[model samples]
Target: MTVKTAEDRLHDVAIIGGGVVGCAMFRACVLAGARTVLLEKGGDLLEGASKANSAILHTGFDATPDTLEVTCMQRGYALYRDICENMNLSVMKTGAMVAAWSADDIACFPAIMDKAARNGVPVKQLDAQQARLREPALSKDVRGAVLVEEEHLIDPWSAPLAYARQAVENGGTHLCRARVESGVREGNVWRLDVAGKPAVRARVVINCAGNHGDLVEAIARPSPFTITPRKGQFVVFDKTASDLFRTIILPVPTALTKGVVVTRTVFGNVLVGPTAEPQTEREFPTVEHDALEKLREAAFRIIPALRDHDVTTAYAGLRPATQFSDYQIEALPTDGWITVGGIRSTGLTGALGIAEHVVGLYRAHFADPSPLANVVVPSMPNLVEERPRPWMQPERGPIVCHCERVTEHEIEAALTDRVLPAGTLGGLRRRTRCMMGRCQGFYCTRRVMELAQSHLPGLVSPTGKGRSDV
Candidate 1:
């Protein structure tokens, strides 16, 4: 069978990014009976700002009321819960608490409660004693907290991957390493000039180009926003530290960010993170020593027991922030373009809802699309620790990665996935959790390289020699 690449065929909708929002947009457009093609500049999906996140599914409890961000978040939250089970995804129901550490934070409680009520998210106030009763691991400095019962944790990688898979399985095209360099509108169609590939023609172009949103948007019209990349650093604690807390510990919100959060990931590791700092680089977010140290200290402050545990790793991610606070989603019918930019931390939770909104825009301005009959929904492999791992199953192959318990079969499947195969080492790690463990692939690198020799190119061997692509 011949694999499909981005051809000269005129697609109905063309998405410019492969982040969570772009993946979700592809899914929605395909389901709505539109011929869609997603162009990702990276080797695989989620290579942009969507790559690293806290992975918390927000409830919009403290979101700015009556804003597009909150509206999309609530709708996306519902849509995710609705489709998770069908897609074989998991959600760890570790609710969150906005712990007040100071008198100023406590003073913000009334406004927080009012905002939650206005946003229609149910949240109850908990006194310091009551908060401590619920979470015995909290520090003595905790004054009060607002219990957000619906906030939860999810696999940040798997959800978007599932969306992309579902779209591909339902007849949508995904072209990786296909960067949109320039575009021009010809009558009713837009011809996008992709780097090294043939120009792709589409009737509608949605700019979901996360970090490069401004540059991409300028191709259609004068960009209404400027993308100032905000770097967020995080520290991951060992899985043993996960036992110290059952709830997501959040700090009071400020004008800049939601503040630092200490939460347990679905993979059974305690995560402390996300120091927001502004930067100009669109890619390559590096973790600084000072930021990591501060995050570690903050984690220790929140859960004193974390100091006893080991630090697994430290990483950083960038978010596409703009001068405005709310999301920038608008339809420019004159140019046959739509801009979905300035989606910062809430993009994960707001993806599906934003997709829905974009579809509405497409229908109103572009063309009337009939919903597809019997759409396909792909079932992703179970990655959440609560679910049964592949290594624990019958007929499981040899365990290649002992720390993450990734089996040889799992790696093979990820490498050869029919819809969206892992194109790079980072993609493979996200798909199988193979190199994201205690050892971080120290022991399994050679075997993984051997398995990927035929599929991936330019991979250096464990002995510092490059393997010829099969």
Candidate 2:
């Protein structure tokens, strides 16, 4: 397939950033029957904060009432329920809890309930005995918990991919590895200059550039906030530890962080930590030794059984924290651009809401709007953790990646994934769960690489088989 140059296409909308928010906006724009083109600086989708999240689908329980964050969360949660059903996305409806150990923490529940009420999130206050009965592994020191029954868990990798895939199938374009260096408004249109590709001309440009939103906005218009990368580290325990908690076990909020959380993932693994440390380096997300000790101590108090479980992996991600508490979204009518910045965390939970909000901004400026004649939802490859494996099928081919129960047939589908611009091993792992299990590719590294080499031509095989790189 020959890729078209920017000159060959004048998109109705060009969206910068291919993270969850950007993908969401792309899908929304396409659904509105616009010619949308998504440009990502990264090699693949969900490579930033979107990938390394805690996968908690927050229900706006703690957000400030009437704020854009809470409103988006309230709306996004409903949109997610529908999208998950139609697209067959894996969503584990395990409710969330804010566990309180200290007296001060317990005192905060009333205010938490007040906030939940304002946001329309139905929450209940639980006593110590009820909390303990619900999650037996919790510390005896725990006084009570605030439960948000609609809160849930999902696989971190798929929602954006699903949206982007649906967008592509609906006539949107995905321009991977295309970083917008600068953009300018020519008359009524915006000319976005990419790093290597031809300059893309669009009627309007939507900036959803995550951490680089500051830079993208500075290119054409004034940005409201400066993005600072706050590094967070986490530990993933194997599925053997999943039984410890039926819900997302969260600690009371602190001044700096949301506090450590111990939650079971949709993939059946138990996730803990996510110690927030504001840092300068966005690229280097190394888990600090002291941070790990702090997280371990927090875990020991939150769940004593954490000591018995073995850690499958430990990694880090940087949040695009900004000076503002609420999200900064503005319609740059003068520049034919829209800036979406300061969406630090919960981008996954509020992605579609943000998209709808941005599209409204775009429509206010771009006249003669076109609506889709028919809507189509694309079906993604089966990546649900609880679902049956391809190997379970009669006479299926060889089995690979035993730790994840991935079969050769599933891997072949990933190698030829129709949605991806480049069928990378990392993408394959996200799509088919090939090398992301407990061993961390220790056992299936060579075989997966060999399979990729045999299937995908000229694809450079990854070394060490680690999550990030060689």
Against the true structure, candidate 2 reaches a TM-score of: 0.94
The number of the candidate with the highest TM-score is 1
Q: Give the TM-score of candidate 1.
A: 0.98
Error in Å for residue 174 of model 2 = 0.6
What lDDT score is found at residue 256 in candidate 2? 72
lDDT by candidate, in order shown: 0.92, 0.82
Span of 10 residues, lowest total lDDT, candidate 2: 461-470
* Off by more than 4 A, model 2: 1-7, 454-470
Please, what is the TM-score per model? Answer: 0.98, 0.94
Superposed Cα RMSD, model 2 = 2.6
Q: What lDDT tens digits, residue by residue, belong to model 1 across residues 1-470?
A: 96655668889999999999999999999999999999999888998899899999999998899999999999999999999999998888989999999999999999999999999989999999999999999998899999998898999999999999989998999998899999999999999999999999999999999999999998988889999999999999999998888999999988999989999999999889899999999899999998899998998888888889999998999999999999999999888898999999999999999999999999999988799999887889998899998889889979999999999999999999878999888899999998899988899989998898677766666666775432
Q: Give lDDT tens digits, candidate 2, residues 11-68.
A: 8889999889999999999988888899987777776677688887888888888899
